[model samples]
Target: MLASLLDSMADSLVCSVELEKTKGITVRVYNESGKLTQTVILDGKSITIKSQGEQKSSTIIQKEDSIISEVKGSEQTSTITQKEDSVVIKCKSFQVDAETVSVKSSKDSTHESGGKLTVTSQKDMSLTSSAKAALKSTQAMDLETNANLTAKATQNVSLSGLNAELKGTTKASVASDTAVEVTGVKVDVKGKAQLTLEGAITSVGENITTVKGQLVKVEGALVKLG
Candidate 1:
């Protein structure tokens, strides 16, 4: 019967996974006078549990051929994979020392954050972060794109461009349509500070094929003075 209709549609997507998806998961042990009794729930999925105080507990359930994701209220010693289309989540380590975070999507979606992710996208967005990263648009033809960035730490970075760049010191701020390049050097003149524009900037030792920052702003004369 065509393998019984593909095993009844894979057992209706693995029994529609429910059991309140394991509730109130926990782990805690303290004795530094920061008192708060013990609590633990290690292994409970598609849940059902009954444990109280002076904690120490364990439960297990496994069925191979893939499809597992239902862990709630903390303590997830990682491994989540869901397939009907594609989904794979593997974690050997994940810590959220949480404070506040949020996410939502209706159609197109791609979101990632190691410890911090806050997104409110109505249309287009590509945000990647290691720490300090910000992009805000109020929707009039909204376009924001960032392919890569890596920063170890050191503040004061802004790019509100018609174009902007510096792929080396890790700072790329662009408000695109024309020009923005750095590290290969070329940042088409605009109110200078550590500036660069490989063609002209005259006087103040004029060989400046374009390197300004002690004061530089070239727009139409393109700077020329030997």
Candidate 2:
């Protein structure tokens, strides 16, 4: 019976047995040189199996518990990007060259880093927007340290205003400072004006000072005050 079983083991083997009538069977398959290729050990209520080969280059499949797959080669993704562009990635060392790369999202996207993000350009770098733009900081610093806004127009650097307050092409500002100084060709005062003369001053206008009374008023033309 053993010799017949060995002679018929060349192609396949099939058996039907009830475990309650007989003990469990142990099936071990070997290569040509009697080396184990696969194993199957059947116990009363469980079966254990193990395959033999170089684990680094073998594909394992099991049927008992959870499956775990491991790949030692490269992999590819079905969807690279929502955008369409050509890119070159070098694997010999490490490098990436792309014509254009855009990062976009449906919602707001923010990029924050613990280190610094420095950008440098050679020929020209411009920041243009169709809408309004602003630059501000919430840190505590001096005027010079806080904001340094420098604009250089090569040909003509002139600032003109539309005189929004019904003035004639005038630009006026109300600055809150300790002291104010006016220097130009000529200073014009429209509203009721007052000046305190400390030293001997010369007059250049028609009415330098006016003295108001009940029904009469006096206007000084060439008055000297000390």
Off by over 4 Å in 1: 1-60, 67-109, 112-135, 138-226
Error of 2 at 31 (Å): 18
Provide the lowest-lDDT 10-residue window in model 2: 76-85
How far residue 137's Cα lies from its native spot in candidate 2, in Å, is: 4.2
lDDT of 1 by residue, 138-194 (tens): 545444446643544455455476664345455546553655444435334463455
For each candidate, the alpha-carbon lDDT, in order, equals: 0.46, 0.46
Model 2 per-residue lDDT tens digits across residues 42-140: 665445455454432222233244222222223321211111333323223333579866676666546555566555666565778556666565664
The TM-score obtained by model 1 is 0.18
All candidates: TM-score = 0.18, 0.25
Please give the lDDT score for candidate 1.
0.46
lDDT accuracy of residue 158 in candidate 1: 53
- Provide C-alpha RMSD values for all models, in order: 21.2, 17.7
